[model samples]
Each structure stands twice: as C-alpha cells, then as structure tokens.
Target chain A: MADVNRGSRPLSPHLQVYRLQIPMTTSILARITGNGLIVGSLVFVWWLVAAAAGPDYYAFVNGIVTSWLGLLVLAGSLWALWYHSLAGLRHLLWDSGHGLELATAERLGLAVVIGSVAATVVTLALLAWA
Target chain B: MEHLTDRKRAEGRGSARSGTLHHIAMMISAGALVILVPLFLIVVVPVIGAAHAEVAAHFARPFPALVAALTIVVAMHHFRGGVEMMIQDYWQGMTRKLAILAMILLSYGTAAAGLYAIARLAL
Candidate 1:
C-alpha cells in the first residue's frame, strides 16, 4: 500500500557533502562573468556590423551606445572584461600550481573583485577623455 | 568501500576533463587576442578614421586588415565556446539544449559569412 503521509522521497545529498574551495569559487565567478561577456560581446558585434554596414546603420547604433542605456551596457561590459581578465590570471596561476593555498586563493579572489572595479574606472576615464 | 572508490574516481575524471576544456578555451582566446587587438588599433582605427572615411580606406594597411580578419575569427570562436558552456549549464531539457546549440552554430555561421564579405571588399 502507498503511504499517504509520505512527505518526500530520498534525494542525492550534494550541497551538504561537498565543501567549498578556492578553485571552485573562482570557477563559479568566472562562469558568471564569462556569460556576461558573451552577451556584451554580441552587443559589440552589432555595433561593429552596423558601423560597417553604412552611415545610417552606424548612426542608429551610435545613438543607442551613446545614450544612458548604452552607457549602462558599456559599464557592464567593462565590469565583465575586468572580472574575466583577473579570473584568467587566477586560472593561469592555478595552472602553474601556485595559488592552491587557501589563504592565497582568498587573497586572489579579493583582488579579482577590487581590481575589476579599479580597471573599469580607469577605462571609463579613458573613454571620457576620448 | 567499492562504491566510495568509484565515486572518487568519477569525480577526479570529471574535474580533469572540465579543467582541460577550460584551459584550452582560455589559451585559444588569449592567443587570438594577442594577434587581433593590435591590428584593430593600428590599422583598422586609422583607416576608419575618427569622423568619416571611405570603407576602402579602412583596409589600407595589410597588417591592420589582417588583424581585423583575425579579430572576427577569434572573437567568434571564443564566444561560441563560452556560450556553449552556459547553455549546457542553464538548459535542462534535451530539446532546449539542442536549440541553444543550433543557435550558437547559426551565430558562428553568420559571423563567418559577414567576415568573408568584408574580406572580399577591396577596402
């Protein structure tokens, strides 16, 4: 007979069993930023294609990219670039087997976050000057 | 004990595969960018000019022209690899996953066609 009062069936235990590590955390963040960059790159592609197409298409894209909305997209792209770059460096270090220590991993993670913001600001400054 | 050992082996295999794929993708992207960015800056930018220039002028220099070609190729390859991984993560159903894969292929194809057209242009 079926148990009418059964609440749930046994499921695989995953989150409770695996402990988080630095490489895992960095990989997760990289995946997120990588996704962001994918979308942002598509936007860039559109702008480039439009520019290449002709003046009218170029103006249309230029109008959008120069607007507040465009600025937001640009900012997001910058963030993704910086995050991905730092994450790439971290992966490079890991490839060389240097940052496996927990403390070093944590420091690098923090640097990735901080450096991304700093780089973005510098890029924005350059864009403004241009 | 046997089950535990099997699970450990499976985990190890999975991690190694994932790490290898990641490394390969990163290497390709890094290598391509090394060739592409400079070309865009030196050749493509000057020819395109700040305000106005004929499309032909844009491809005036061979080095910049080659860079533009590499940029399209490398950027598309890098983008497709990243997007494929993302689709694998977020799409659970087989049909949806297949759809995403098709979309990625279509995108790469379009970019390739566009690049070919640009290359054929005398500018």
Candidate 2:
C-alpha cells in the first residue's frame, strides 16, 4: 500500500551525515521567519479594522495587542522584519555579484541574527521612551 | 567526466526564463522594502502607545500613511515571489498548486485590506 522502504534508498546527503553551518541555518530560518512576519502583519490588520469600527473597538483590539502576549508577537515580528530584510539585502548582494565568498556569506548570516536583534531592541527602546 | 558540447550543455541546463524573471522581481521589491520598512518603523514608533485620536491623526498625515501603505503592498509582492520559490522547491503537482494559491490569496487579501484601511485613514 505504501512505500515504507523508501528511506533505505541511497538518497542525497541528508542532514544527519554532516555538520550544519551558519549560512545554511540562516537560509532555512529566513523562510521560516518570513512566514512569521506574515502572521504578524495580521496584527496590523486587526488594528486598522478596529480603528475603522470605532474607538471602543479600537481600544479592545489595541488592549489585546499591547498585552504581554501581544508584545511577544510584536517582538517576534520586529525581529522577523529586521532579519528578513537584512537577509534579503544579502540575497540582493548575491544577485549583483557580491558576497559570493564563503567567509563573507557566513559573516552575512551572522549579521542577520545580530542586526535583527539590535534593530528590535532599538525600536522597542524608542517606543518605551516615546 | 561526461563528454559535452557547449550547445548540449546549454540545453541540458534547462529553461531559466522564469527563474531570472522571479529573481529580478524579488530583488526590485526587496530594494523598495529596504527603504520603506525603516521609514515605516520611524513613522510608527513615535506614535506607539498613543491615544486613539492621536494614532488616527498620525496615520492621517500623508507621510506615514503613504510610507506604510507602500511598505505593506510591496512587502506582500516580495513575499509572494520569495515564498513561491520555497514552496516549489519542496512541493509538486497538486500540493504545489494548492500551496501557491493559498499563499497568494493570503498575501493579496492582506494587501487589499491594509490598503483599504490606509485609504480610510488618509482620506
């Protein structure tokens, strides 16, 4: 009924066979965080719809979005936004015939992680101050 | 090593017409987002935790409204092109069709709703 034995075939190199590197991991994470960003965009939609609906509706929606859970989603979203944007920049560099070197690629990958974290912190800190 | 003529190798590599197109579209959108996102963050961050009237007033201003609406719409376009490549890489046949359609609709729906809200706020 099912080809349960397909796993035994000599397939391409699988994950278990070797070590993973930063660039490799970041590349995969880019797609994941992209999806996360999409979900986060819905928060904005909720805000807009509530605002149009009226002040009471806006407050209700805004209250939920500002709660601890909402903050977490916002934080995740901020990081996703930063990370994806930077990674996309890296891809653009590649498209333009730069950052093709292995060392530079790995460095770019690390920058995505660090840059996103920094941007999120700065944005949140500014929000706190404002 | 396998023997190959230049023409044979070129033909074997397969059609890349759509691949280049996708790459260019994605890059253009990425270029726009690189500017729009930061501008949007700058605009929105100042108004965080603000009162409803204040928030509405902030968005009603042309600069924030325009930056945000463009960012949302362009970002969706970029997302669609990029995510479709990922989906195609792992999916095929019916699954690919369904997944691509679902993603496109989500992106398009988001873009439309977002623009409508911005239009209401701005106008």
Candidate 3:
C-alpha cells in the first residue's frame, strides 16, 4: 500500500529567537550601511575616472551626482558612512574591553545613530552654507 | 566528560595562519579611518557643488590631495574587509569564493582609479 499523506513535517522558523531591541536593530543596520558604503565607493571610482577622463565627462558624471535623486542617495550614503564608521568605533571599543556593560552598550548604540545624523547634517551645512 | 588537553590546544596555535591578522588589519584600518574620514570630509565637502575646475584645483593642493589619497587607500582596504565578512555571512560554497575575489578586485581597482585621478589633478 502506498502512503498517501505524510505526517506533518517539523518546520523550524528562526524569526522569534530574539525580541526586537535597539542594539540588535542597530547592529543589523550597521551591516547594511557597511555594504552600502561599498556600493557608494564604486561610484567614487566612476567620478574619479570621469574627472581624469576630461571636462565633458566630468560634467556628465557631475550631473548625476548633483541631481535630485542623486542628492538624496548621496545624503543617505553619507549618513551610512558616518553610521558605519561609528559602529566600527564601537566594535573597536568592545575589542579593547570597554562598553561591555548592558547600559553602556545600549548607550553606544544610540550614540551611533545620533552621531551619524549629526555628522551628516554638519557635513551638509559645510557643503551648502560654506 | 572529555575535554581537550592544554597541550593539544597550545599545539594548534595559528593553525589557520591568519588568526588575529584579519582582526588586527581591520582594526588598524578602522583606526586610521577614524581620523582620515573626518579630515577627508572637511577637505572635500566645501568643493562638492563647485565647478569642475574649482574642484580640481582644491584637490590639487598638497594637503587636500594627500588626505584624499590616504583616505581612499585606507578606506578601500577597510571596505574590502567589511564586505568580505558580510558576504561570507550570506553566501557559501563556490559563490562565496568567487564573490570575495570579485570584491578584492573591485576595491583595489577603485582605489587605483581614485589615486590616478588625484595624481592627474595634482600634477
């Protein structure tokens, strides 16, 4: 006799392992921003190549970076850059045997987020208001 | 319960050969970046929306040009190490090896490109 129905197979899904928290979310965001910077750096290569290529090409590449969508992306990438760098600093602190306490760890996580925004804003001000 | 002996553990020192090297290299680059990145932005942001000639001249200066060069080089190294870890986390098998190779090429290629452009501008 052929078995028509198999008994319910066990399904293990991993989504519920940890309740959402700032440190966890920020850690994931750090990974995201770290990779985001890689992609953004590729564009830096293009811009540099275009700069060396000539004036016409420079203008062409410049147009893209200065455009509205490009501006948004540039701003976001700037934020990511600051965020990623700050997160790396936090890691370095952890490596040096600092910020191991739970309260300090959470504070450092929050500082990364706040500091990134501040850095981005200051940069934009320097760029625009200078 | 059986546990590994201290002699056995001590014998396996640096079996991977790259033990702590990756961590140390990455941390070194990160430390350099902590300074270079801010200096780069300070030297760079003012010239962003300016004309091409203006931007070129700004980088032609020794200070800005040197800062930019160091930042690009160190940043690419950091970027490679970070991205490699992230990629390894998501992919495995042949794809992982291939992706890591591609990332290395991309990082160095980009670094070279930026350096060349800065050289062209400065010289």
Model 3 chain A weakest 10-residue run by lDDT:
A1-10
Q: Where does candidate 2 clash, by residue pair?
A: none
lDDT of 3: 0.84
lDDT of 2 by residue, B9-58 (tens): 56745765788888788878888988898998888656645678987888
Best of the two (1, 3) by lDDT: 3
User: What's the candidate order when arranged by decreasing DockQ?
Assistant: 3, 2, 1
Error of 3 at B71 (Å): 0.8
Of candidate 1 chain A, the 10-residue stretch with the lowest lDDT total is A1-10
**lDDT for predicted candidate 1 compared with the true structure:** 0.65
- Candidate 1's residue-wise lDDT over B1-123, tens digit each? 333554454564454357577658767696666556545534553332233245545544466556776766776677667667677666767866786778678568756754654564435
Name the lDDT value of residue B40 in candidate 3.
Answer: 79
Rank list by lDDT = 3, 2, 1
Top-TM-score structure, candidate number: 2
List the DockQ of the predictions in order.
0.19, 0.28, 0.29
Candidate 3, A1-130: lDDT as tens digits:
1332335866677648778787788899988998888767767667766776778999998899788977887788889999998998898989999998989999999999999999899888877877
Please provide, for model 2 over A34-73, each residue's C-alpha lDDT reduced to its tens digit, 9 standing for 90 to 100. Answer: 8678878888777876776668988999898889998888
Better of 1 and 3 by TM-score: 3
Worst 10 residues of 2 chain A by lDDT: A1-10
Candidate rank order under TM-score? 2, 3, 1
The TM-score obtained by model 3 is 0.86
Off by over 4 Å in 1: A1-9, A12-26, B1-26, B34-64, B113-122
